[model samples]
Target: MDSHVFQAVAAAAAALLLFLTYHSLAFVAGKKLPKGTRLPPGPPGKPFVGNLFDIPPEHSWLKFKQWSDLYGPLFRLNIAGRENYVVSSEKIANDLLRERGNLYSSREQLPAAAELLGDNLRPLFLPYGSLWRRTRKLMHQLTMPSAATTYQPTQVLESTRLLDDLIRAPQDYQKWFARYSSSVIFRLGFGKTMQDEDVLRRIMDVNHSLERVASPGSYLVDTFPSLMHLPDALAPFKRELKQLHEAELGLFRELLDDVKKQMDQNVAPHCWERTFIEQQESYDLTTDQGAYVIGTLFEAGSGTTTAALQSFVLAMVHHPEWMSKIQQEVDEVVGTSRLPEFEDMPSLPTVRAVIKETMRWRPVTAGGLPHQLVKDDVYNGFFLPAGTNIHPNQWAIHREPSLYPDPEVFNPDRWLDPSFPTFKEPLTVHPNIQNYSCFGFGRRICPGQNIAERSLNILVARIAWACDISKAKDEHGNYVDVPLYDYVSGFNTHPKPFQFYLKARSPHHAIIVRSALEKETQSDPLAGK
Candidate 1:
């Protein structure tokens, strides 16, 4: 044989040996299980690659649900040698994320999400430790159920603006919703209403980028952490991610600095940012940490609230019967003399039910953020190793037929029916309900849920009370069919841009909306009178 051919064969053999040895060691290290233990059942996958190709970039929760049906409530997927345990059963989800939360509350380290998107600094993605604990404590203090009441005037004002926006340019209802949602968060977190269009655009752009990066399968570096070490020239993904991180950090810093400027002038309104800056030492947070803490609040509060309000609008357009019922309740409780207020929420159970149904009908985060196990654990005779990704599949859990009959239908009646198996009042709690799984579970449950629920309740109630939401009509005077399930897929699923016909229910309601706007514009704009 030629010397060159022999050399090439020898190099190939050496490379193969190295590959095998690395994988063998990795497998043994990950699976430090007792002899009788085994992983839960899952679909088969190819060697080396595992289920990398099987995981789609968008709407992955649907696929996970399908697998759960076939593989039973608990299943596993090996994505690029990473073990992902998906729990579709409510019982299993409760058992792991709630019952044994100490073991499963930490967040997994995603190179793209944590490092590139700068989410590692945010408590939402932080592991269960000092930083996370402090951040969460601060967030809880600001957004706890009682604390949420302090923001009622802002919510009421923004919701009234939402009503006026719908009455004026109903075609841009989605943008109006986005504006209202962002404005509320801005007021709460920064003590200022969102006035600069450019600032709003930048914040939304950052959120869109964050969503893509944080998604499970969008970045290969998340699956193959080793790739993070490659040089910029060879690993363009890393360079791009670094740029994204800088951009996000710059934005957060800019917002924080603006708040400081206001404080220096003694002109700043009461906001979370101002409070954070004042008590930074108490929270043991650096300047950067303080900025990201407030930034995370805006990021989480704005996008999710916007998506939820959009969902409520979509539900109204599709299910007019429920809309009419809710409207009737609002009219009976809050007459045309004025709009609905936060206090009216208790008397209007139907409106509250609609809010709950909207969340369940189409959850914003279909597959809740992945939780990481701090140590190897076993449940139901199955061994789940440390570092396993736990997915509490809210999409599947919310749609269980036994829990919600005709789960596909937008039925608010389920909450009102005493005979229904999982009926509960929507506004009775802060984080989640016994029947719903929208806010997530356990230690990492959304800390801003109380404020979010209040924001939704006021906006949804006011919208139902003041406007008539219906299908848009085409030039030919024919009703256009609004696709019920049309939504933009990402870490946060939102209704895609769609047309709807929104108009004041009566001239009296129109007058009330216009009067409220005029009064607010004339008096203290911040008061939202």
Candidate 2:
């Protein structure tokens, strides 16, 4: 054949190959969806790789909201070949997350997390099965309402340290808040005070690292799960995950070993780990089971509680007038000499509103951990296919103008409507805050919510009573502008670092703060002894 004939033949062969590939993809797409079933509206994109590249490098939540508006309340996005449905309305979220909760409780498998970091042991990622049930029950026993009262002293002591730290070095509010969270959990989980040198720092470091890796945007390996099967050397994230895994494991083991040693020596203070380990046989828990159960409790309870408290501080600093109002309420209820206690929680309406507003303003997990559907379901005639991941967009729901008027402004009054009935009102769910989505929704809601709320309530009340929190200003004495939206982009949207001012409300409050630190003996676990 001539050279021109050979070139023509090669061009024809290339065209045929492209046609085959397109036809194959078309066949797959056809089989993927049922006939006459319309997928939720979403950003238009290329075949088999829909809208994956459209997601922003940062503030993905903001991007998601814009897409949800352009599309409908229920919108779909394919990220790295996996399908995700962002539920933007409270009603839709309720139908899927609450009404059909059993089928929608399992988390999407994060391969990097499951294999590399989690050991498939973390409660948050546990499949919705017997294993998850057992683990959750254990957490509930330890953190539910009855159990929360037992943990009150730990909350008080830690918040005392927080108030003192804020008064002493207001500039380091972020670090102090992190430290407070670390210390609070340390006492509850390990029966050790974080006042031990560098203890809070070490714990905070581990938690911060875990937070970074656990978030949705942490690693490409999570987005493209096929990469998980690749060897450690070839995958860059594998090496990074290994380091994080080691750091996390080391810290967890050290705390566990300390608790074990204390138990062995009969010097163990009453802590979650010590209590559980002591009764492991009665609970039918294997040593590994006990370790993981306790570990999950430590991880889930600590990170979320810390994030909430940090958000509260950030909110108060940004909205000083609200802080003042809450402080006034605290003064009327509890007064200056005595710090507010857990018992005051129900009585202090303003304190409760502040807590609710903080959660509303910036929920810790704005786009909650995605729940994977186990079965095909239809809501209001909209088909929800199995294997689709669902995330309730709390940011959009809370900011809905119809649900919360003037949503941007920090106003707690919205919650205090006298005629606003409790659970009796169809519009309101969890009116007593017992089952607020802040903890989460349905059967898979956070088990540690009671303990967390008790801790938050006591801390916020006492902090407001003893200290005056305000924003730091520029050298010109002008109010320092704080980016209210300056949030660390992550699965859990905690406030990013910001400067703030916290001073004792009065000389009497200053005395209380100083005395609380120095006279730690009053808070000494062995006070009676």
**Best lDDT goes to which candidate?**
1
Query: Any runs in candidate 2 off by more than 4 Å, and if so which?
Result: 1-28, 32-37, 197-199, 282-286, 419-432, 517-520, 526-529
Top candidate on TM-score is 1
The digit string of per-residue lDDT tens for model 1 on 1-529 reads: 5788767765765565447545844783465676788879998877776777997778889999999989988999887677888988778888999899899999888888887778478667888888988888788888887888988888877788888888989888778988998998988887777788888888998889988888777886777676665546556788888888888899889988888998999888888988898898899988888888888888899999999988888998888888899899899988879888887877877888888889998999998888999988989889998888899998998888888899888888788877787665443432133234788888888888888888888888888888888898999999998887888878899988888888889998999988987776666455531
TM-score of 1: 0.93
The global C-alpha lDDT for each of the candidates, from Candidate 1 onward, is 0.83, 0.73
lDDT score of residue 120 within candidate 1:
75
Q: Give the lDDT of residue 477 in candidate 2.
A: 96
* Cα error, candidate 2, residue 218 (Å): 2.8
Q: Write the per-residue lDDT of candidate 2 for residues 1-529, one digit (tens) a residue.
A: 5788767765765565446445544643554655556778788767644566788766677777787778878998866456689988777888888888889998877877766776676677877888788777677777778778877777777788788878888777767776776666667777876666665666666656666777776786676565555546456788877776777667677778888997789888888888778776667665555666676666666777777877888788777788888888888888777788777776787787778778877888887778899887766655677778898877776777767778788777777765432213322222245677666777788777777777777888888898877788789998877777777776766777777777787888878877876677575874432
Provide C-alpha RMSD values for all models, in order.
4.2, 6.0
Total colliding residue pairs, candidate 2? 0
In model 2, how large is the Cα lDDT of residue 91? 77
